[model samples]
Target: MDRIDGGGTMSLHFGVFEVYGPQVGGTLSWPHPLSDSIDFADSQHWVDIAQIMDRTGYDFLFFADGFGYPILGDDIALGAVERGINFSGYDPAGLVPILMRETTGLGFVITANTGVDHPVQLARRFSTLDAISNGRFGWNVVTGSSQNAVAELFGHTEMVPHDVRYAIAAEYVELAKKYWEESWSDDALVADPVRGIYADRTGITRVTYDGEHYRSDGYFGAPPTRQRTPVIFQAGTSPAGRAFAATHAECVFVQATVPAHTARNVAHIREVAAEQGREDPRIMSGLTVVVAETSQEAHRLAAEFDAMQTDDVVATLYAGNTGIDLLALDPERTLHQVLEAGGPVGQMGTSNIERFLGSNGAPAPTVREIIDDLKGKGTRGFRIVGDPHKVADGIEALAAETGLDGFLIEPVFGTRDIAAFGELVLPILRERGRLADRVDGETLRERMRR
Candidate 1:
């Protein structure tokens, strides 16, 4: 059971889907008068945002990794730049420490593309954050999806096979786990001033692991963190991705536009975990809430958000994510047919079309269909635009339908949007005994698992 709050019980948790660099996609294609006021580039802005989440009693804050700007027909896609798609931003590794210092109870989850990052270096960086957060750190483990990221990071032009990439990721995680868990004993650190000792030297020992993709020999340079190994989080829902999550991840990101279908996915993963003799991982879906006192006003806000996603912004973002540039493809080729056969598959084949097929369990969507879907979109996920009651109903419905543990809110207006949810929907959830209203002293892992 989760920790009970002052007058309510914790039935669900909430986190932000993304709190990325200042350059994150926004009111680029259209007039985003309010968003212009937000300075994503300023480190203080994030600190302020972290404080907001902390005050709101949010479970965690997460940031995404970007290789570079989006690429379409040109080496550097100018259209994307004008549309304000992908661009360079602050490093999460760097940002997490800053946020850790600024806020408490708000866990920080940052991405580490296991396909490209060295296990030892990853362990050190994550361990440092975990220590700083006092074990309030979690990792969003990803196999690189962007081809640009792959080429620049690994010096590889052609992509690796999808399953093989996961296999590599599998080992990458294993080796990192070795370092975080086996390197230092709980009593290794002996900061005894009178004894003239800072550590029990004998308690520290080297941990060696040799896998198909990585090998390491040495004790983890960092001390044992709050969570011995930070809680593992994964995002891919492909077969290989699902398998890996079942075996290792404590939490997963599911693309669940269809709640009934997502229920099946959740059940399947839990079954897999049971088979592995591990507890089920918490399942969190992305949520967007546009709430106002009046339903009409909420709808207006939704429309305003919808206007900003231009054609270039939509295509570039989709292409960057799935490695399938619908604009670059032969218009005559049916996207569904090609995707089924691994059409122009990248390293991990984590394309939108593949995810669409798996989540929908319907015919592969056509190229025209995908374009139609992306036109003038503000954001993705299951968005609820209505008065406070309706918004709360939608959240409860989705959780009941899919057995979801929580949602990661992705807002267009950043902190203001999150504030609206905290103000409008949170009270209702609290009234219904579904929200955690405070963070006392539970570890991040404890909070998520409960």
Candidate 2:
């Protein structure tokens, strides 16, 4: 927690932000020689990445996932499929145990939707993962995206309002806590073979809940793991989302492109956390670094990656995240005008728009301008294109300015960017004591706190 001016080594935690699908971001460089065409269906791809991250001093791997894809009118968007724009992927939670088995000292956080998954089901699932990982597991709790599409896929007639979904998530998490923390006492599992008793039945309690959005009446199926509840990770920046994260999240994720905006977000979340009688949660922002041996080489590589980005891919991803269907909107209309018209905004829509405005620097921009700007950023967040030294300086300066505890290293072109950071920048960070010393038997929560 020491700062540069404080005359102590700064220790910043780092994690890799990844998607299980082929298109990790908006970039369409899968066909390019530099890009990695990972087989989404293969577990080996994840295993390979996990080992690399584990060896490269990464604290964890965070996966962003959902069940629904972008849509055009009433059908799935063709661009989403053809362009491979964050379209398809398998559930990443299933990869946690696999990755844990494949690596040492590395943690895993997978996305789970509170809207669609039952509290009991989610609680038990995470409990199983927690046991498997020996406490190296975390949960990225989400309300889900593509509101209408997800609702239809889940067989719901109507979509839950943005704020209402958070209200429900609050209750959902409350009930899940009962299953995770209250169902079994700390000494409930007593495997005494000589006494012919596997557990202390009296210590186990049945959980009963009847909330507005969920109801449960049963004993938890899983027992306490190393950490009874997995570390809670949330990325909701809307008013309700921020409140939810302030109350429950142990680590909060943000995507404000500018350092000043990111600083404000961290301060606001800490203020809310203080108001809620909780300690400051660890806040990490999205970051994609394109680095090489020299500054010129890095910029050239970044330009090459940028050239692969297309308007259709950007718009498709924007529509998928915000549910606005940018391709259908008036190209001449400003973002403010589009918001004023009022269309479907998905769970992530509000935060995404806020980041767009912050990055664009006020003065609402036209749809065409938004698309053009998004082609470079596209919700992937702050990017640094330079050599090892510049990348290190930017990271240290950002951490000092924003008071962020961590950075989620998103990929610019598959894991190539990650490898570059590990090889070039990580050494500088380590030399400067910007990263925590690795410890054996450290849980995900413990590692992240460092």
Candidate 3:
């Protein structure tokens, strides 16, 4: 295939609430005094949401999972639960089959970290899900971020450095691909009635990989799914992460806070992929949408969301993800102080910090600045609050300017927000020829290719 011209337009592939689960609502946590009022423990509601996403022409629903909770400010996670903030939930993968069963045609993407699961076990589990979902499965490869997660589950004191983790991930993926793509030939499965032969023995081969981080022996157990290897999705923007995605990822998730930054990252990935002899990978950025009948209503909704956000909860969540103890800093102190202090707790790396801070400005925004921005306006990745046409226009403008593949649509209110996007913004996108008509029976790869 020829390179995608910088000028050529492409149809956007939409993803629903699949990326972040109900946990997002907890970002501000439940505003209601009663925790019972908002219940995410129930899986049935998510199943119903899955059906809705599939019916609405969403290409896929990607699930983002983390192994540990935010452990900041002496067990502030408790506050997360009390505030009904995004604290408690089952594993995102556990919810995948439930959602898959409710929708046919909607792709299912699950996050599995190399730091947590063994290579053979992880590969087998993904293979099983691929079989169960009839090949509509993708893995968002993640090397976990939380130290609590690593220490609690794996008995490690903390996660390895970012570069080392990616090194491990690179080997893990290479071994997995060998098992998924190279182990079994396209003609591996041949059921012969006369001979009662299920699979041609000659067609299957063993995978023997001895790498620095992982090793696996024997052929892949399950037969190849529709897409032999599930679509590879990755979310790393660091140099090492970009290198890994360039070689293996079919889809790349970016967390830039601005359109220009997102565009730069997308271009970098494409350039790296070209150097790696791979076609351009689809790039999706994390986006939060606030939509209403009018722009004014949208602003009101955003304000309501901000009103719901508590600084304590935001600080806790931030510290949890960044390994920074925000409580140590005076709330009044600017972010520049923290940068100057250069404490190990919050200073993970430049790229990691930038994910929270928009790249357009200097020493990165302070916690106060970030919170204020979220309150007044939204950050990065497309924040448009308007009627259907207005939202569509924002999406188009972002696409045209940044050259993004699509968005991982985050809903303000669990499933309802995504449902609204499908009902309202989708039609306008279709009319503008930015989205493709529903294509029946297409594999995830096929749909994404379109």
Candidate 4:
């Protein structure tokens, strides 16, 4: 609560990864001891939580998205239905206006797949939000991981190749950027009642973009906002995805592997940005923590929650992703060969490949390894379990170890999870000078960009 002015060893950014609607993933279908009793179905629930986060000095509240439920075994929706998996709640963009109206400081970052959106519409939507929110909006660009969702949900019978999807994302983002950055001159809007004209029509210009994936030319329809382009956030870990982020992203979300792995990722991203004549993007790692009054209590809480990874859960989610049933793979074959024999290279999933799921250069994992990884929060990101002090120590050490920008907490409960963290660990962080000084009127972009 006290000011640190121009001093602090380092100021780590903070954010929470939670749903705008009902919950999904490991956050749902599990017992929540610290969960808030707020009604998730009601709009007020989101607004109140947003306000709480803003008051606590969070940088942003991020919502990840997917079009469909995770597929387990044969039935695509059964496992999700039985496990109470809610893929999406409210539309993040639509709900942004509501949250913005209620809270003054928190930034909102929403994920949108490049494979599905029209460049122009996506551009206008974000540009409009930025202007209206006073530059408090951000866009998290993703080349969707699920082939089935893209095909079935979006009505595309043929799934786009993973690498090719990145190519398309490149064009999609380029076109969107042109609209956000170049389509209209800053002085284009002139409201002059004295001349009896809201003129400056001469300054307005059109954007024309043509690429292998898309073509568009039009006068931009969105008015300029605080940040002409809302802060560009990207969360791709693949080589192509990393290259794309280096070229365009302002905030890069990376899965937390080991400290060395994350440190390497941060260095590579900065190097890529430098090559593109840009500074290093603020790099954030996903973190899921289980903490209570004591280290023993925290571990007990974590152990109490069942993983709920039945065969049905694994098969449904895996099949929906790569369209290859793990149960069907030959037991004697190595995973590398099994995948090759399963189907085309492009169709084999790129998201859960060896680098992300298993350790580096380690031979492909056995089917047992696959199940273990998918069960609960396996190899997902940075995970810590302990009391407030221990949790704070882990976070501080990791940030110091990896030179990370900050972390997006994968909320373990409802709003209470975040509230508890703010009350518990935030003071320790403040005392240690890890969090940035709270600026009264800092714009979201200014807060993160610095």
How much lDDT does each candidate structure score? 0.73, 0.82, 0.70, 0.73
lDDT of 1: 0.73
Best by lDDT: 2
Per-candidate TM-scores read: 0.91, 0.95, 0.89, 0.90
lDDT of 3 by residue, 180-248 (tens): 788888998998889898998899998898888887778787787888788899987777777788888
Residue range with the least summed lDDT across 10 consecutive positions in model 3: 29-38
The per-prediction CA RMSD against the true structure, in angstroms, equals: 2.9, 2.2, 3.3, 3.3
Q: Rate residue 89 of model 1 by lDDT.
A: 59
Residues 2-119 of candidate 1 have per-residue lDDT tens digits of 3445554337888886635543432242246655323766788788778988887788987767564555653656655565566545677877788988887888899878766688
Summarize candidate 4's per-residue lDDT along 1-450 as a digit string, tens digits.
222235656678898887655553433433455555225667787887798888877889888766755554434656556654544455777777888888888899998889686899888878878877788888898887556655767778677877898899889988888887786678877777788766377767788877998998788877677687878899877677788889989999876767998898888998999988897789898888777888998887666544434655665555555655666666445457654665534554554554533455656667766766666553247888899999999998998899888898876667766776777888788888778766766678888865
Off by over 4 Å in 3: 1-8, 18-22, 29-37, 73-76, 84-86, 331-342, 345-352, 355-367, 374-380
- lDDT tens readout by residue for model 2, 1-450: 322322386688888888888867656767667777456578887787888888888889999888878777787888889977778777887777888899889899998888786788888888998888899999998988877688889899888888888888899889988888899999989988899887898999999898888888888869899888899999977878888999999999976657887788789999999998887788998888999999999999989988888888887788778876777878897666555776564444787776544354556677888888888676687888899999999998988888888788888777677788887898899888788788899898878766
On TM-score, the candidate that comes out on top is 2
TM-score of 1: 0.91
Q: Over 4 Å off in model 4, which ranges?
A: 1-8, 24-38, 72-77, 86-88, 306-324, 327-334, 344-349, 356-361
Q: How many steric overlaps are in each model, in order?
A: 1, 0, 10, 6
Error of 1 at 373 (Å): 1.8
Residue 101 lDDT (model 1): 88
